[model samples]
Target: MSAVRAIEPISRGEFSKMLRRARPPPGWGKSIAVANSGGPDSTCLLYLLHEYFSSDGTPPGNQRNDSTSNSHQKANPRIVSLTVDHGLQSSSADMAARTARFAESLGVEHSTTKIPWGEGVFPPLPAPGAPFEETARRARYRTLFDEMTRLQANALAAGHHLDDQVETGLMRLRLGSSMLGASGMRYCRRWGMGNVIGGLDWAGVEGMRRWIVRPFLGVSKDRILATCEANRLEYVVDKTNFQPEVTLRNAVRHVVKYGKESAQNFPPKLLQDIETIDTALENLPNFDGNLNSGPERLRAFVQEMGREVEAIEKEVDEITHKGRLPSPIGTFLISKEALEGIKDKPLVQRALVLRILRYVSPNPWGSLRAQAKRRSARLEELARCLTTPMSALSKPFSMSSQVLWKPVLKRPKIVKGKSKGKVPAGWIASRQPPDLQNAWGVADRDITEPLLQALEARESEGDGGALDILFDCRFRIRIHLDAIPQAVIDALAAGITNLSIRCDKELYYPSVVLRTPKNELVLNPADNPTPKFPEGIAFAKPVDWVSIEFIRTLGNI
Candidate 1:
């Protein structure tokens, strides 16, 4: 591992130094949203800003300047704590409500932006599966960004501290991240509402806004905890954080649990490595060229960049898990290359993956989720039968969103030679009932594709074939951030689609790797011979319903 093995304590002066370096480009305005989960890290940041304004050395109100000697509060930067209730636990809303009250006392105007409670955002949720966490995080962020717009806040702050940084860095490293991701959390990252896609999440110039800020990013959780204790700051304890099996983050936290180390004792080299990685990342190329392109072109570009990005990917992975800055420049190239590569796809998908998968596949989403293990394997074996194996492998070179969900009929009899089973002809994979969904009904299928000759085409939902497929269904639902109610979740359960139910509080998930139904997990397009999901692990259980947790517990898969 690198010198930045774990979260080390930091003195106020040291934190101050880090903050100064992280200062945003002035004009964030007076109205700010502090995304406080009521955790100590966020609580401490809110308090610190309030205290900064309250201090004697601070300049008079409205005197805005970077100087610590001339600190001032203009319009007092309305410090509102936006607590997102992802309704995974009974205590979730309670914690947020309590946080609002505590924030009110701290003089921070707090508002609970319950992210559209259960059955809120779309694409619906699958039953408890490994995909829940990643899906929920995206939902949570989508809500937060929407709230920032609704609240008209110029800036948004979250509670990511040193430990979070370490975790992120480690995750990025573990995930075949480009070096930029493995650099850990930054005090100020561009916004997809504080996402990796920066401003690329939206297409138009109007969408480019650096509205999110992470004030406590440079500080450690220990310092925040200490600050809370010192100032008598009260916060909720997320029990899941202590549980080792819930997520990789929790597992790592258990591995690098912190003790009572004073901020005065942080290692210099750790700081140095942080700086080095940061600097290297800063110097990497910004992908501004893919300004306009179709999905296919972007896919080709991403794969092309993958070869060039390997060196950095290796280093970030090394540093995150092994804890070492294997090669700074190499790491820089990886992130830079990919960012440049992915700019042409749907802004949301590209940004979502960039911000996250630095840790899943780091490949295009459509391509990653498509295909079966045995099919891909068989395809490879078939390739070996070609006139030139390498040239035949070129068929896999293309990626198409159209191909992502293409339901092809399988000619099993044609492939019976490859397998020991007596296969029937015309057996399509899509036609095979998904084992999991066997219990749940499917829903919202296309009523019609298009009536090219008729004006009524615009009024159609979709073709009858797909609609016929999903006659009726329901899903076990979970909300990343709370807003609506259990009733809505119930309605969805009763009305929507195929599902099984289970709820997990910590959906802090890993990047998704494609797992074919036949037991092949592809690490991502970024890696060679795709790695297996550790320990034969294919899917994770994403809690289906938060409401159920109030009454019972759903154990592991």
Candidate 2:
């Protein structure tokens, strides 16, 4: 085969266009943060952002303060640089400090957060392997998110590029990932720690959300290096990246760019270990093809998969919009008509069911690849069951902590002796109620801490602030801080900690309640949905503070 041709370096105009297409949330215009590690990719991104913001008349961080400029005219968002120092290497601190200095030189705000690895926060790092890589990454992102929230930024940017996307797709393919899973990283997405709960208004939230934008996903790594070189910028190189034994990603990088002979560069014992891993992976049933084939072919394959994923997502949105019923307090409803429409196409049906299950699941679907596959198979079965006639419907079943009930059809009127055919409504699905005898199958989640955290964030943003909190991982409750009664605010501030949401046993819907440390009730919606309390603690007039909704699809929130 002929050698691959070298690509041209990215021009400044092209980089600008890519940034425009990155599509950071509109709220990010007020303040945005970047994850800068003092590497070539990040360093170039920092410089370009500074340049991009500066090119538009006024520089970033210079919000107009004169009387002539109104609040809306302060369009240049403040740029913040965040560095997570893992301290895995001796030079980690120094690298972070250098990055801070570089950012400050460009008038960008900077902060460094040190991960307390092995210090009770995160467990001691395991020996160099795939597990170590995953652990380290989790620690790094957790720190970054904490800092971003405290700083009140809107979004965090990462330096992931097209090469990283190709590597991720290849790795997923080797591990037997689903087609949608193998599409690799998204250009803009919610934080992975939180599962994909879609459909939230982007404007009203306080502080930085769990969003990470990747403008460079379509830009090649070589272009990043070229950008840094052409502008005469210096960056640090992490030497450990060259050592393949440290992580699977490093090993894959070697195999993709170099050949199998790259393993010979390691010591005799290490070389043997690399070959063993390669053999094991190749023996897997779903290992698609040889990674030794150049990166170009792998890049093309991921692009095609990405197109297919987009097409599937579009179909999902269409069916969901046309036939979805407005979700009640704790249940998800899909019209029987919708299911009947897609009855013959099992692929679309399976995709729709998987999305609904993920949205209503009480537990987050973290890196559980095997369990996800099993659940996918079960979801496919449920999808097929939707096509069964109402007369043949089976008993209610449970999956992912939610109960899929038999279809609820509108009954015929009894005015006439002869009955009319049944009216089609929809299938109702709900969370499994907690059962004392069946401890293993019980479903319960206490969202007190998350609620408290959100309230604190709202307090920091002052009055009239709005934010959405996920209750029991099922309901999206949008809280308007200004509309909350002063009594509830005082109760929270006075050290009452037990805030909870419970479903009515008979009605099977949700209600809000607050209690003291000993579980003594402070406030209960059941006492009166709108009651007057002592100290003139009446429910705010026309209370529109809290609005609840349910997710219908898998997209960015």
Q: Per-residue lDDT for 460 in model 2?
A: 84
Q: Tens digit of lDDT per residue, candidate 1, span 1-557?
A: 66764443444556556555555565556667777777777777777766654454233344436554433434445666777887656798899898889888977666786555444333354354443666567666666666776777777777776557655654454544443335555566445212222221221111234356676654456667877787788887888777645565655454444321211233454333333433433443543222123223323333344333444444333323332112211111112223233234222222222222221121221122222111333333322222121211123222321111111122234454574443211100111122233223222122112111121332264432210110101111122223323443343334432222211111211122222334422221232122222355344332221221111001000
Score candidate 2 by TM-score against the native.
0.74
Which digits, one per residue and each the tens of the lDDT, describe model 2 over residues 1-557?
99987655666676666766665656465667899999988888888877776654343345545666454565666788999998777798999999999998998889988887676456775554335566677678767877777887767888888888877875665554556666788877655334323312111122224567888888778878878888888888898787786666787777768867776777565565456545544553444555565677656766777677778777888877787887654456888788888888765776677666554444443213212343546666777777665542345666543454556777668665876657657777766665532322223344556655766887787656665665545445565667767776677766665555544443234344456555433233332233222232223223456565543224422
In model 2, the Cα lDDT at residue 249 comes to 70
Q: Which candidate is the best by lDDT?
A: 2
TM-score of 1: 0.43
Clashes (backbone N, CA, C under 3 Å), per candidate, total 32, 0
TM-scores of all candidate predictions against the true structure: 0.43, 0.74
